[model samples]
Target chain A: MDVRSQVSMVFHLDKCIGCHTCSIACKNIWTDRKGAEYMWWNNVETKPGTGYPTKWEDQNIYQGGWERNGDSVSLKGAGKLRGLKNIFHNPYMPVLDDYYEPWTYKYQDLFTAPEGNDQPTARPVSLVTGETMDVKAGPNWDDDLGGSPDYARQDVNMQKLTPAEQEVMFQLERMTLHYLPRICNHCLNPACVASCPSGALYKRGEDGVVLINQERCRAWRMCVTACPYKKSYYNWHTGKSEKCVLCYPRLESGQAPACFHSCVGRIRYLGVMLYDADKIEAVASVPEDQIVQAQMDIYLDPFDPKVIEEAKKNGIADSTIEAAQKSPVYKFVKLWKLALPLHPEFRTLPNLFYVPALLPSVGTVNNGIYNSNTNGLWGGIDTTRLPMKYLASLFSAGNTETVAEVLKRLMTVRWHRRNVTVGDVDEKTVNAALEDTKMDTATADAIFRLTTLATFDERFVIPPAHREESIEMLENTGDVKGNTGFGFKERPARGL
Target chain B: MFNATLNQFLFVIFPYAALAVFLVGSIYRYKNKGFSVSSISSQFLEGRKLFWGSQPFHWGLLILFFGHLIAFLFPRAVLAWNGEPVRLLILEIASFGFGLSAFIGLGLLILRRVTTPRITVVTSKMDVVVFLILLTQIVSGLCVAYFNRWGSSWFAAFLTPYLRSIFVFDPDITAISGVNSWWLKIHVVSAFSIIAIIPFTRFMHFLVYPVDYLWRSYQQVIWNWDRRTIRNSTKHSEGEKSTNN
Candidate 1:
């Protein structure tokens, strides 16, 4: 067992309110520069609508991740020979138009232009060309109107549902939307790393942060093609690929990432997860249906004495182990089994997990009585506003049972709490709800507390990064003492 | 020097001068700006034309290069290989096929540069000049090959001796003058001029070939050229992983 600690994250989709505060926060901190204005490192995508970079999940067009051959898998778009052949021009790469023609208003014109008879307006100009242009599109053009046919009709997930079901989803009253704030998965099996011909992209051994070394990037642009999430962006100015660093500088200092800190709903959870490194390939190579179980099996329990001993032997700090034990991500993902990795079928074995949102309103209160007139306090998963098949495709590789199980556990918690707070839910129905979900009172109560009322510390159990030793090993510590800066001193430029 | 004829300058002075500049300039470039050595490609700007232009051009050029190399280095072997009349016919036909492709590809590329607005905007004067020079060289070489059929069989007897004489510092201008073909002279001089101009242009990228890329692992971490520091940190990271297990 080659035990290694990966700094994993879990976003509880239930609590997400679809505010793009996280997106703005991350953009302001990381991507508000030349060639990067269009990149939103943390964009909150409204599900049922085609996302930023428009229909990124349609791997048929983008060819982003691994595709199953007979027994093994290869990158859908690239291999060694194919990569070299297409190095001159990537056939599958998305251009600026695919994301959006990022624009800024000609504010100078507003200030400097001579006053006219009509209201003088600052016309939108393309950031790339600095030319006055019609405002065509944006990063989140289909923001709140996820159910509208103009945007949601193109959603890749809609293909999984039957025609009738799809038609039902578009119904005015039945139309429901949920936020899916995306960042780089920082996958254990990163196709971007494998696709990079220059080998500029690598997952750091210490923290599992995938970074593109700007100095070494040859601008092959394969990373942009290989990232299934489309998180990697090509900086035309720098002639290099850039991606989300997961705010590693803040992570090392025991602070939440900018997006996480600024999140209005506090949906993001950060923590350490100890997994057996030896199993990564085997787990990732399995059939799509078995991928979730395989991923779960890879993550060794923090409380396991054998795993704990091996972790210490592998040079993991004691504090990090303690933090792993306290990680809400670990509880949500491995223990409570509430969260699932997005598109596990993509087979990247993504590090970021999502607790599938229970979007269907359980019941309405009529005359001060909570009326869930079903078999018990919780209604059937099939009747939820967000269809079971949709969540299943997103989270469980079309395993409706898995999505149902998580939703049942969540519903049990809700019903359990409702019984306590309000007398409308009878004692028998409450017990039945718990029994039907097969969840104990203690687990349900814990889930309720963590989901609803978790403090910042409880939500993000940051492990001590201990980056000094790594840096000291790489350079003369005494010689480096005077300098205090992040990343390369020189700005990366084209042609080298 | 003003009194020197064009042939006198092209044959003797130009060869020596070009060779000297080529060697010195290549060395200077390798030392001062080693990292900037890359074939900066505008393939991303207008790729469809490049697909047609670049593929045939690269293939024809590569095959021609090896053909020239083998013929030059092992003239006796080439003579023996061409003893069979049928083999000579095959060799002549293949050379014509490759040379035609090269000609066509080069013509299309030049046309593309002028027509494609995106590529034209990035095209420097040096790039245009180099393109025209290559076109002239190919045309001259093709004209000689077409006019003097079975020249490859006889080239060993004439040009090889002259080239060998030059390599030995013997300066056999008379032996090259023995061929007395203006087209051949134009081809050789233009080819030499291309060599001289290579270091100053984007052709420097061809020097740092990506041969190592074929067999390497996907993930690579560059350590800013400090081997010892990288090794130590790698060991430390391994230790971190090992103890954590």
Candidate 2:
């Protein structure tokens, strides 16, 4: 089976509150450097709005990821011939203007003003040039204004919706928004790794963490265009490309990643998934509509005796296998089938899965008693604030049934929970809802527990990384014992 | 004796000294300061100007470099081909065209580097030095091509033998000493000077050009330990579909 262990993740979009605490935690840990001021390794993007880098989802403009070519896939922007052809000056590369010129207030001016004016204020200075500039944009410029014409109406996914449906989405009372906290998906077939001319970016075989060897990165900037998610960023000061490392240093020590640990709404789930490496190509090569199912099928069940034998033969530790068995990600993604990978059409076979968020139920209280006033506790998927086609575009490859099926399961869980806890939902309707979605009470309850009330340990099932086993093979660890600092051996500078 | 001594210093001693520095310094930098080896592009800060400057400069330089290499490597073939008047004219004109392109591209690049405020922030002292030396070399080359005329024939007849003699440890200077044009002499001297400073500047990036990328597998998976054993053990096994059954 060519079994391999990947540290997979599931971000429950339902629970996310768009607080950006995860972004701050990630920033404080990794990207608070001179060159990385604009990089947000963990960015909370509001769906139905143009994301960071402005309309990044429009592949025609950004040209990130792969396109299916008959039996195989080719990079949309970069490959051997095309990459070398445009190596000198990449036309697709997004400049600092695309990501918004990072700036900080000239607070010194606030104190050192001539004291002639009635009020003193700090002027914004560009981090790139140290020149005074007008503030035009920011990373989260359209934070909660998902209904605004400038950001939300311009969403690339909104192209799939009918004009009337798209117009209805902008109505003040009917408008809905959800937070999509994004990090590197750490895809099985990563375009960033393939696009790197210097062979600097590689997916570590041990844990499947994609990383850029800064020493070997020649500033080709191909990865910055090849990455479908626009996660890889070029550092102007360092003259290198950087991306999310999935907090591997913390992960190696058996601690959750900083973002996962500090997530305020507890929307993040981390666990090991044992996947069949042989299937990665076939899965990624499939048509866009079949990609999600093909990708999920590649993740082998950890408890299967034959799969466990193959995993052991491939040198996966028993504890990691056990962690995979108990993985909350596996249950939400594979078992309950409630979560879906974001943009499966990208054909990178991304490892991160997202449970589609259920929009707030549309209902009215007739007189006094608070009633949901629908067939069940919640209305049908069609009646939700965000259209099914829009969610389909975001998660599936415009597969509305997949989105509808997941939402139905989530709705059944809510109904099942109401019947159990509150006793308001009648047994007949709840059972029928459960039967209609093909989910039993136990499965619904389990999905509910993992979705809503999972403990820290339950949510983050970190396996022992066994880094020493791998590190010893590469170099003499004893020689590096005295070196504690993390800065480069030779600082990244422009010239000699 | 003084003229002969000067010719020996410039043609033999100076060339060898530069070659020594190029070889030793490059190896040392590669082994120790691997992290600093990169093109160190500033395109992110400013790209539009770079597109105009970088593409033409690179293409022109690459074509000229390979053209010189062919002439030096196959002097007999170049000389034979140059025997025909029409052929000789075409070769000279093509070389001059490429040289002019390189000159114009470099001019734009220098202007962008000097005038653009953002680019100035990243331009180091060494970068300016490299740029100035490169400018001198290109300008001297264009001057030789324009004024000297039929450099293809003369270069094949004289400089090829001189370069070959130096590589073979013969240290012949008469082949280049008889040359009258100062522009050609300056071109030879400045070319050696560039080789000397290559290791100390961003030019070291050329040494590690990713030529293997053309043939190597696109997907790069790095394993700290041996993965062949892992692959072999599973080679005979069926995929997950069979396992499910």
Candidate 3:
């Protein structure tokens, strides 16, 4: 089977409040440097609004990720022949303008201003040029539906909706939105790794964490276009491309990543998944409509005796396999089938799965008064206010049935929880909801606990990284004992 | 004696010293300061100007570089080809055209480097030094090409022998000293100087050419297993066991 272990994640969209704590935590640790002023490795994007890099989902403009061509897939924008042709100038690359010019207030002006009639102001200055500039945009310029007409109305996912359906989504008082916090998907078929001319970017075979070797990066900036999610960023100062490292140092020490640990919503779940390496090409090459299911099918059941035997035969550690069995990601993604990979049509085989958010219930406005309680708190999964087709486009590659099924399972849990806690929901409806979704009470309860009240240990199941084995293959650890420190010998800098 | 000594210093001593520095310096940089090897592209700061400047400059330089290499490697063959009057004229004109484009492209690049405020922030002392040296080299080269008609023939006949003699450990500057052209002399000295400073500047990117990308598989799934076993999968388990041991 050629079994391999990949650390996977599931982010529950229902509980996210979009506080941006995860983004800040990641920034403070990894990207809060001179060249990385604009990068947000962990960003909370408000759906129905254009994301950080502005309409990143619009592949027609960025041309990121892979396109299925016959039985095999090819990079949509960059590969061998095309990459060499555009080596000097990549026309598809997103400029600094696309991601907004990162700027800072000239705080010194407030402190060192001369006496004047008017109060001294901290004028905005471009971080790139250090010149006074009019602040046009930022990473989170469209937070909380700010500039809805310009940003939210331009959302790429809204294309699947009819004109009338689109209008209802933008109605002043009736609009619905949700927070979509994101990090690197750490895909099995990463186009960034494929596009790098210098062979700098690579997916770590042990854990599937993609990393860029700083020494080898030639500032090609192809990865910036190859990543469909716009996660890879070019550092202007270091003259290299940078992206999320997935907090491997923390994971190696058996702690959750900085963003996962600092997540205010507690919606993030981390775990390991075992997959058949032989099936990745076939799985990724499947038709767009079948991509989500194909991806899920590739993930081998960790508890299966045959799969476990193959995993061990492939040199996978027993502990890692045990972690895979207990992985909350496996439960949410495979066992319960409630979580779906975001935009499977990208053909990246992303490891991060998302539990699609339930839209607000449909409400009727009577003589300028809104009555939301008439149809109860939760609406039918098929007739959500945000439209199932929009969610389908974002999550299941236009498969409304998958989104409907996931939402139905989530609703069953809510109904089951309400019947037990509040008792307002009728027994007949809750039982029928469970039966229709083919979900039992036990599975619903487990999903609810993992989704809502999962402890830190329960949420994150980090397997011990057997660094000694990997290290031995590269260099003698005993020879370098006490000789190396855990920091960069020389800071990454540009110029001769 | 003084003229001979100076010629020996410039042609014999200086070339060897520069070659030594190029080898040792580049190896040291690659091993110790490994993270510093990069093109350090300023395109992100100002791309539009870079496109106009970099493309023509690189294309012209690559063509000219290979042309020189061919002449050096096969001087007799080049001389035989140049025996035809039409072929000789075509070769010279084509070379001059490429040299002119390179000169113009370099001038545009210098202008962009000096004028752009964002680019100025990243400019270092070595960058200025390289730019000035390149400008001198290009200007001198262009002057030699324009002033000395059929210069390619003389280069292959006279200079190629001198270059070959040096490589064979016999320092011969007889042809070079006898020619008595300041433009060609300056061009040779500047070329040697560039070779010396390559490792100390961003020019080191030339050595680590990403030519492997052309042949290697596009999808890089780096398995954490014995690389030998990946190449020869029949001994996969045996190789794995040995590596573990």
Every candidate's lDDT:
0.79, 0.87, 0.86
Q: Which 10 residues in a row give candidate 2 chain B its minimum summed lDDT?
A: B236-245
Off by over 4 Å in 3: A373-379, A466-475, A478-496, B221-245
Candidate 2: lDDT over CA atoms?
Answer: 0.87
lDDT of 1 by residue, A8-54 (tens): 99998888998889989998999999768888989988888899899
Docking class for model 2 is: acceptable
TM-score, every prediction: 0.83, 0.93, 0.93
Candidates by lDDT, descending order: 2, 3, 1
Q: Write the per-residue lDDT of candidate 3 for residues A1-496, one digit (tens) a residue.
A: 8888899999999889999999999999998889899999999899988997999999999999999999999999999888877777777888777888888999999989999999999999988889999988998999999999999999999999999999988877778889999899999889999999988988877788888889889887889889999999999898899999999888877899999999878999999999998898899999988999899999999999999888887777778899999999999999999899988999999999999998776777899988765453336665577788999999999999889888888989989999989999889989988888888999989988888888999999988776655554444444444554333344345669
How do the residues A150-214 of candidate 2 rate in per-residue lDDT, one tens digit apiece?
Answer: 99989999999999999888777678899899999999999999999989999988789999998
DockQ of each: 0.23, 0.44, 0.40
Best by DockQ: 2
For model 1 chain A, the run of ten residues with the poorest summed lDDT: A485-494
Compute the lDDT of residue B101 as modeled in candidate 1: 85
Q: Over 4 Å off in model 1, which ranges?
A: A112-115, A361-380, A478-496, B1-50, B57-209, B218-245
Q: TM-score of the candidate numbered 2?
A: 0.93
